[model samples]
Target chain A: MLTPPETEPLTPEDRTLMGPGPSEVHPRVLRVMSAPLVGHLDDSFIEIMNEVQDLLRYVFQTENQWAIPVSGTGSAAMEAAFANVVEPGDTVLVPTNGYFGGRMASMAERAGGEVAYVDAPWGEPLKPAVVEDAFHQHDPDIFGFVHAETSTGALQPNVPELTDIAHEHGAYVIADSVTSLGGVEFRVDEWDIDVAYSGAQKCLSCPPGASPLTLNDRTMEKVLNRDTEVRSWYLDLSLLEGYWGDDRSYHHTAPITNIYALREALQLVAEEGLEARWERHEAMATQLKQGLEALGLELNPEDEYWLPSLNAVRIPDGIDESALLSDMQADHNLEVASGLGDLEGEIIRIGCMGYSARTSNIELVLYALEDALRNQGYEP
Target chain B: MLTPPETEPLTPEDRTLMGPGPSEVHPRVLRVMSAPLVGHLDDSFIEIMNEVQDLLRYVFQTENQWAIPVSGTGSAAMEAAFANVVEPGDTVLVPTNGYFGGRMASMAERAGGEVAYVDAPWGEPLKPAVVEDAFHQHDPDIFGFVHAETSTGALQPNVPELTDIAHEHGAYVIADSVTSLGGVEFRVDEWDIDVAYSGAQKCLSCPPGASPLTLNDRTMEKVLNRDTEVRSWYLDLSLLEGYWGDDRSYHHTAPITNIYALREALQLVAEEGLEARWERHEAMATQLKQGLEALGLELNPEDEYWLPSLNAVRIPDGIDESALLSDMQADHNLEVASGLGDLEGEIIRIGCMGYSARTSNIELVLYALEDALRNQGYEP
Candidate 1:
């Protein structure tokens, strides 16, 4: 028998979360996490599941009946979209502009699809003309693009144009709305996206266990008619349909408490209408952007393509990014993230999302950044 | 624009949870779920991750270095175990005794492995002689068996004997300890289990998001040198190693609140001590069994193979199983489960694990069951 190690009590420090994701959760959502669990198949839980699907439809601005929470984090939903839709030998077109598009290529490849790229530089959105060229070049069966790139802090403009190109080429379009849903403006039906997936921890401000995914009828029909079984039995959409569809049968045990937290988070989304929520995020991020500019920093993305939920600020010369982040954490109990993938060490990401998009959090982030800059012997 | 559906406040009825799994979360676990969020890569969150690993090692009674929580529920962890370890064209052996074994076959097949089975009837443990015969007949590369079969309320006795057979045949042993970890007697190292996976909602009494998985070094070596990419990228162990291993790098975003709950639940396990906790489960379940026997009900499994955490009571003739379950819920707000798969409609499953293994909960189950039986006009 192994001797148990003595672990101290869990008392995590309460910090102002303004990171790239996992924005601070609403108090109501947090409280709901403490609620006792009902069995995953309980009638009440099934009702809760229905309401979540309904709310997800509202957020996506669609009437797709396949809106539901996948039982994992954002990447699971992303994989679910690709793994189910992209069949063997299918040509998949993905953008090379941001981190998540590379992820889509990986998932599509793992799903036995041939991957083709639509190239755009880092921190820039894809041009409709470039996408059309790629579709014409590859005649891809599936097209995936990031609506809001968390790594680049760029939001794709002219979504309808991109979707129109895919549709004209007889392709399905998948949108990575991870950092945009419930915060930035996005429309699934109007934009004609076949499938869209988002994380709960980002703009929804729920914990990251269950993630939202929606698929229109055409996409789900392809999934249902796949010649080969989905390589992942746990994420196979055909198997999951029995549980989430009208049958309400058993597939697997869901994260009951996470569902409760997500429901409360979506309820808050409904209470404060979607358009108002988007405006609040933009207004707060604009304040943060102005403050960073006053401190002699430059935002990475262009004005027209800026992502309001995730603000990527270019690090100034002679400033140690690691030291700046540590100083802010030590002095103000504040959190902002270093850039990911291609932008690592070149930028800092500060988020204004859902519950964390208030004036108080934005002010604290600005004050802490200024303090950290002064401590680093840089006059900004 | 889609109109948002009006959702009522979340007010799920509180019930005494005693089912196959998710047997009543500990109060400490539930309280910690409401704590503030931390970045998945935060230093403090990393420390908590270390503590959770240490506690999991203690409970598993293993000093293996590759113990960590998978980011999704139990099935995800189960898939993680198979999808990484079983290479293409490998012949994997699993038991045909319970519901989970069939699931194992599905996962192994999905991992590009051919599956063979050792035969055993439902509600009975796999015999060591039969396992040895199967190994000799099929020459499998991997063998998986359930340590505690949740669906049939049977526990495999003589675990070392089974592992010995597999080892002599040069086969890796995987144990499904979903219904046994932290409450029943399960020692991964002692039983020579190369891999073991479990759910948090089971014996750990945490919520059902993040799950526990451990692999010994020899097993991980096979995984790191896999011939093909693991089918599921989200569950790829080589990728997960960058996050949970010494690197502490980013994988996908973890379910932060679920990790908090798992840590608290494992801390409770550490405080109680594993042996003491196991004895408590056995004692409480004994009381429940005695009460049911007095009421003229019969448990399905023989005493030697009976699982203390889950009791499978044979349904009496002339009694409607569904109505009995409904009455128990509608009258007392108590949650017990009908049997699954092979045992469906023939038995009722009452769980006695973790926080639900108290004398008070056992008494309540007995009282509620008696009332439900009386309401069904089945006097005993």
Candidate 2:
């Protein structure tokens, strides 16, 4: 038998989260997560479920009847979209522009779909012309691209153009909006996106458990008419439909506390309104970006496609990235992330998302970063 | 655009959770859920991860080095086990004993395994002779059985015998210990369970995310040596090894608050020794059973197979199950479950698990159930 250690009370560092995702959670969401849980099949919880779905649709900018939170984190929602829509032998087109697009390819291949590539270098968004060329060449049944690349901090523009290309090719389009769901400008219907998935801990400012997923009628139709069963039973949408749809039955137990937190978080979104919230993120990120540029740091992506939620700044010469991070963390209870995937060691990711997107946080981040840089013998 | 409802503060009905799972969360765990956030890749969180793994191993009663929590609820962990171990064309043997067995078959088939069944009626434990017979007949590659059948409230006895049979057939064994892990007696290593997975909500009395999963070296070998990739990218344990294993790198953003809740819950388990905790469940369940008998209801399973965590009591003749549940919910705010699958309309599942496994809660359940039955015009 294993002996249990004398564990202390759970008192996390209370750090200011400025990472790629999992921005600091809203106080209301945190409080709601502590609320006692009703049974998953209870009438009250069913009501909560309906409200959560409605709130999810509001933020996703879609009238898709299938808008709901997948009961895991962001990657689970990502897998659910691919695993359901892509059947065996389906040719799936995925972007190579960011870290998440590579993840999309991995999920598609695991779902038994043949993955075809739409080429773009890392840290660059897929151009509509390139997407069109790829569609003409591969004729994929499904096309997936990242709307906001968390790894590269580049937001894909010309959404309607990309969607039109897929529609003309008789392919479904899936948008990976993990970094920009609530705090950025996105329209599912106007942009003609058939499916989109997001994480709660991103722009929503909720904890990372239940993730947001929406599927329009066209996309769900393809899922429902799949030639074979979805390979992941835990993520099967048809089974989840019984629970989230009008049936309101038990498919599996949801993360009830996470759902409560999400409902509260989305309610905050409704109160603030999506447009105003997006502006807030942009305004804060602009302040941080100007400070970085003044401190001799260059933003990685072009200004037109700069992601307001996650600011990626290239490391200056003679700056020690690891030491700077350690000093900032040790001196100020703050967190900033290093670059992931192809961009690793080249840039630092500073998130201005959700409740973390505020003038005070931006100023504090700039000060701490400058102080850390000075300590590392770099003039700021 | 979807119009947001006039949402009030999240005020879910304060419920006495006694359903199949998601029992009343410990107050300490609930408090921790409201605590501040930490990045999943933070050094602080990495230390907490080690502690959580240790605590998990303690409750699971295993020396297996691969013990960690799957990032969703119970079913995600279940799928992770099967999706990794059961490769395509493998003949897997599963029991037809309860709802979960059917679920296991579905998951195995989705994992590309051909499923064969070992026969047993609902609410009954599998007999060794029958298991041996099935193994000899089928010559299966993998065998799965529920350690405690939640749907039917039957505790599977002779665990060693079952594992021995699987081993003799050169098959690995996977046990579903969702409802039994913390509250009841489960010896993972001593019983030779090659793999086992459980939910935090049931016996742990934590919220339903970050479920417990452990695999012995033999099981991990099969998984690591598999020819094909696991179907679900979110649940692939080999990739998970980078985060939870030695590297402690980022695999996915974990549900940090849920992990905090689980650590507190597991600490409580350690405070009350496992044997003492198992006896507490047995004692509380026995009291509930007597009260149920006094109310002229019989438990569905026999004493030897009675599950201490979830008790399946026979619905008295002419007792309206729906009315009984509604009245109990409305009047007492107590949550009990209606029977599922094969035992539907015949039994009501009353849970005495985790924090809800106490004399007061058990007595309250008896009183409320009796009052509901009386209101339904049933008498002793």
Candidate 3:
């Protein structure tokens, strides 16, 4: 028999979360995580599910009845959307501008769809002209793009135009709303995107399980009429509908505690009206951006496509990016992430989201970052 | 814009969870779920991951260093095991004895495997001879069986014999150890289980989200060398290795709270000692069984095959099963489950698992069940 670990009780370092996602969880949401769990199919949990759906609909800004929480993380919700909607032999057009777009391409290919890219450089949003040209060139069946690219800190500016291009080409549009859903302006119905998926941790300030997912009736119809079985049984939405839909039958154990935490988190979002919440994110991010500018730091994305929830601040020359991150973590107990993918070592991502999108957090981040940079012998 | 839900704070019913799964979670685990947030890739979290892996190995009774928790619930881990190991055109042999066996078939088929089954009636273990015959006939690449059938409250006997047969046939063995992992006696290495998957909510008394999965190197080799990609990107073990392995990169956001809860729960398992914990479940179940017998109730599974964690008791003639279930919930604030799948309406599933396996809970269940029976006019 193997010896058991002398593991202590979980007391993780309480860092101020300002990274790409997992922004600070609201106290109410944290409290609910410790709440007693009922059975997954318990009558009470089914009621909780209904309430979460309603709250999710509110957050997603759509009355789509298909709005529900996927049991895993954001990627699971994303894969659920792609695997269900993109049938084998279908042509799927995905963006090549950020980390999530590449992830989308991988998921679509795994679903047996031929992946084609609508290209835009990293740290920039897809232009409608390029998107339309690609749609005409590829004749794709499904088009996926990130509404807010966390990796690049770029929010796609003209969502309706991109959706219009897809609709003109007779394609279903799927939006990766992982970073934009609650903290920024997005309207599922008005935007005319057929499907959208987001994570709880990013803008919701909930923990990272039980991600938000929604599909319009048109997309749900396509999923229902799929010529091929959805590749993943765990992500099969047709069977999932039996649980999250009217039947409320068991699909899998619905991550009960995460759902509870999400309900509380989304309830917070609702209390702060969605638009008000978005403005809160923008205002705090502006404060952070002004502070960074005072330190002579350049923001990576252009203002038109700047994502208020995640700030991509470019590292100045001779500024030790790794040292800046470590000093902040060591001295300030704060979290600001280094760049991802092609932009690695060139930028740091700082987030303003949900409960974390506050003037106090913004001030702390600005103070710590400037202090760390000064320690690295950088002065404007 | 949709109106926000005027939902009150989550005050779910304070319940003593005694269901087929989701046994009463330990207090330590519950407390950890409310712990502060950390980035999924935080250094502290990586250390926690290592401790969880070590604890999982001890609980699973294996030296397999590949043990890790799959994000999502138990079914996700089960799907991960099959989708990775059972490649296209593979002949997968599954059992037809209970609910999960059918689920295994569904997953295997979705993994592009042709499913063949060794038949046994519900609530019965697969005979070694039948399994051998099926392996010979099908020449299957993988053989999966449920070690503890939660639906029927029956634990498979002679596990070594079953695994030995698969080993002789050169087939990898996957065991559904969901119900038996901690509360019942199971040794993954000793029993020669090549791959085993379990849920956190069952015998571990942890909330469901991150689930236990382990693969011996032999199984890992097969998964790594697969001809086709795993169907579910979220459950793909190879890519998952990049995150959970030495690389410490990101694959997906793990359920942070769930991992914390699981770590706390597994630590409790280690402190209690695995064999002693199994004995506690067996003893509590014995007490419950004697009480049911006194109430003129009969258990569905035979004594030798009884699963201590989930006790399936037969419904008496002329008794309303729904009334029996509803009355207990309505009166006692207690939760017990009705039968599922083949055993539906034939039995009531009573759980004596992890934190729920105390003498006090046994007394409460016996008293409540007896009272519910009397209210239904089924007096002894």
Which candidate leads the pack in lDDT? 1
TM-score: model 1 vs. ground truth: 0.99
> What would the per-residue lDDT of candidate 2 be over residues B332-352, giving only the tens digit for each residue?
999999998999999999999
Model 2 alpha-carbon drift over 4 Å, by segment: none
C-alpha TM-scores of all predictions: 0.99, 0.99, 0.99
Write the residue-wise lDDT of candidate 3 on A87-154 in tens digits.
99999999889899999999999999999999999999999999989988999999999999999899
- State, as a TM-score between 0 and 1, how close model 2 is to the true structure: 0.99
Candidate 2 reaches a DockQ of: 0.81
Residue A98 alpha-carbon offset, candidate 1, angstroms = 1.3
Please, what are the lDDT tens digits per residue for candidate 1 over residues A196-285?
Answer: 999999999999999999999999999999998899988999999999999999999998999999899999999999999999999999
Candidate 3: what lDDT? 0.92
User: lDDT per residue, candidate 1, B182-235, as tens digits?
Assistant: 989999998899999999998899999999999999999999998789888899
The global Cα lDDT (0 to 1) of model 1 is 0.94
Instruction: Please give the TM-score of chain B in predicted model 3.
Output: 0.99
